[model samples]
Target: MNPTSPFDAERALSLARETLTIEADALLALRGQIDGAFVQAMQAMLDTRHRVIVMGMGKSGHVGRKIAATLASTGTPAFFVHPGEASHGDLGMVTPGDVVIAISNSGESDELNAILPPMRRLGITLVAMTGRPDSSLARHADFVLNTAVQKEACPLNLAPTASTIAQMAMGDALAVALLDARGFREHDFARSHPGGALGRKLLMHVRDLMRGGEQVPRVPADASFSATMREMTSKGLGATAVVDGDKVLGIFTDGDLRRMIETGADLRAMKAHQVMHPHPKLVRDDALAVEAADLMEQHRITSVLVVDAAGHLVGALNTNDLLRAKVI
Candidate 1:
């Protein structure tokens, strides 16, 4: 609050760097603080038969929400409940089997502390995430996660900058440990976040986006070269599969036609089998859509024929199909 000092760009930059440095140091210090207590807290959460309820007040509440969300998305079931609301019948949400994670920098937020005794009496496990291990909140807990920072990043040492970061980091640490213990995989994460890009890559199968039946551009092995070109043009997939009784024999593409014309080959007399590229790239109908994308990219091809377990042509898809579905 210097009234006489004017705005200086260098000062602004210096303060920003200082704040980041302080926060970074605080996070690094947290690594050493992770001891038996953290393990105990993780065990308490893992052993719980019900949800992990996160409770906090003020800035700590904001961090708690993110922590709860991260925990939920990563394989743990959790939700944030405001400490102030917990006193007014919201505490009823806490069942006997649930574990509660209470966040407070001072370990003595009046709103949060008010319900801790009742929660303990209700036979729910209490985990205190606090900067002060000796505070009342920590003393009443079944387990304590000490998130103490040496100092606040704020120049006045008043704002909850460094302290909040520590709390969030601690929450993430617990969540990740629990995730690893449960053998959580990307597919599991995708299940919780099905609307995200990773979900599309992991959950979407080739059969989900592939053109099946009549939509598939196909021609018989004995079909004339002109017939192949017509199939490609009509399907607009840039390629056509050569099949015999549903068994894929080969593939013909616009590139193949261009090459035939460039080499002065007789397009008029060629059959579909003669002009096609034999043993073309093929993806299984049950394969992940991202796997199809990888196959196409690796072979420098734009389209791939989809087949079932029996090696019979079931459908087809291309870069456009993947693009349309946002799979790629």
Candidate 2:
């Protein structure tokens, strides 16, 4: 009985790397199997008027839930239904127009197979994702998308590693195909993920987070520098817009005042327009808030003017406002 050498860390890492390589190769092989049936599955889902109801058991169930979420977020309305629950009266959730995607490695999950008959009776289209094309679920399916893997990454070939990855990748393929078919745009995706950073970046318009009406720190271009300073202080935005009618002529910021004073420019003798930085960076009302943030960062400015299509100063926003809105 020779004792194992003090838990060889390097050997453990080597084995882990080998497992990852095997899984990666398996996925690459799976990609080659996509064919007409894959297209048919996507077409079936797109043609269905009701939501996609994903069903599976055990590890497949977990993967199915994630697939359902990805589909919903990408513009296909979908949800997961436990097949075991469907056997126990949850089958009522399935409707005639819905498409059912059943996931199982062997395509013979008893609980999942149990709900298929009723789903078919209700006129629901069945799309089976399985490793075995000859299995019961695949035999009954209107379309079968293969997720077969030659072997698991596990040494004993028992774990669901390579098979689960294939299933998830196939699910993604279905989602992306549906997304393209529906012409799902970035704005649509942003609407679904409004609480995420990407949503804030793409969906939020400058006008949505800008300070307008009386809250805007603005002064006439010809007003005294003292008045501009007073406006900045009263508004608490650290800057003031110098406007002439509806047009923005310049901006007077704390930095601008500092430079003006250092240049021996007398505030008492100068008008706001004379000392203000002219033609400051401006953004359109419809511009994405993230783009506004990028412009401000590029110019090293703390604030920006929100203008309408005709270049009229409609609103203003500072760094603090962007931060508050979580657009940064």
Clashes, model 2: 0
Candidate with the greatest lDDT versus the true structure:
1
Model 2 earns a TM-score of: 0.90
Candidate 1 TM-score, true structure as reference: 0.95
What is residue 182's positional error in candidate 1, in angstroms?
1.1
> TM-score for each prediction?
0.95, 0.90
Per-candidate local distance difference test: 0.93, 0.90
Judge candidate 1 at residue 227 and give its lDDT: 87
Error of 1 at 93 (Å): 1.7
Report the lDDT tens digits of candidate 1 across residue range 1-328. 6899898999899989999999999999999988998898899888888999999999999999999999999999999999899999899889998999999999999999999888998899899999999999999998899999999989899999999999999998999999999899999999998889999999999999999999999999999987888999998989999999899999999888898899998899989999999999999999999999999999999999999999999999999899987888
lDDT of 2: 0.90
Give RMSD to native, each candidate.
1.6, 2.7
Residue 209 error for model 2, in Å?
A: 1.3
